[model samples]
Target: MTIKYPAGGMVSKDVQPVDDDSVELTLRDHPLIRRYGRLAYLVIHGEPVPAGRPRFTRQGHAFDPKRSRDYKKLVSEAAALQYHSELLHGIPLKVDVKVYRHVQSSISKVERAKRLSGKHRPIVKPDASNYLKLIEDALTGIVWEDDNLITDVSCSKYYSDDPRIEVTVTETGAKRPNNLKEPHY
Candidate 1:
């Protein structure tokens, strides 16, 4: 799915396109996260290395502690800057939000089942499709504003107290012509 930002203004930015195929990749092998061995790379270090840096330098080369610290900070800011530019240009990101609640059990079937069946069969687990329905019921809506200047999303799940995750995306900082719209995700 593609979402464009700044739907009305002449200026817009194209942030990272959250793709179905790449979601797992982003969540698992994200370069920034993989580099530091923690998810806090962006949140703690600052910005990501330039897209071209990896091509030039070995991904696992060791650097001086001081140099590593400085470069790490630089990349974090770059990431934040890119996101802001995308917002100003009205760029949108594709995102999927899911909320889950654990189910409570009130039954003791192990002893009873074994006695009734005369053979101890493995326990059959209930499918999660039913839980997915609950999550679907919890989804409310997504909103984007001012041609992507600001995108706000709220849901029924947001109404209660749950640990919510907010993901802010920025454009790649590639400047377009004065009178052109960047490609949509």
Candidate 2:
């Protein structure tokens, strides 16, 4: 039998021949496969915006708030700069997102120093999950095929003078361990 590669290379092997006598392996050199097991990094240079609650109109239609939409667009643009084509699909992924919020100007110099030094973190509203939600939705179709493929995620928020969101994505090679214990019943 003959195996044909996408790069116009053919290799003859002593294997069972199918009816066609030629086998074409398409995914061997796919872009996603090439990027598998590697890390993808991106930074959105601005204040990190968390996913906002959906707004409903009197007509019973649901829509993302203007702020949320704008933030998602910004995130998508940032991700697009790093990845041009071939979104990852059907692969487990690990995502780490760090959100940096600007320190309040009203705080004292000592408090500002503490915030900038990472000694004082942001413990206010718009939790980490909300930030992750916006990032995941924005990255969909640009970084990966779907957000559900992300098997592991870590998110944190901090106060910084130069506010931004840093994202790192890696394709997990194998099934991740599920730490849930079986029910004793």
- Please name the candidate that would achieve the greatest TM-score relative to the true structure: 2
The lDDT of each candidate is 0.29, 0.79
Clashing pairs in 2: none
Each prediction's TM-score versus the true structure: 0.19, 0.74
lDDT at 127, model 2: 95
In TM-score terms, candidate 1 sits at 0.19
Clashes of 1: 13
The all-Cα superposition gives candidate 2 an RMSD in Å to the true structure of: 14.1
Q: Residue by residue across 77-168, what tens digits does model 2's lDDT show?
A: 76775554467788788999999998999999999999999999999998999999999999998888899999989999999877889988
Q: Give residue 105's lDDT in candidate 2 (0 to 100).
A: 98
Kindly list the per-residue Cα lDDT of model 1 for residues 114-148, writing each as its tens digit. Answer: 43343532223322332222222222122223323
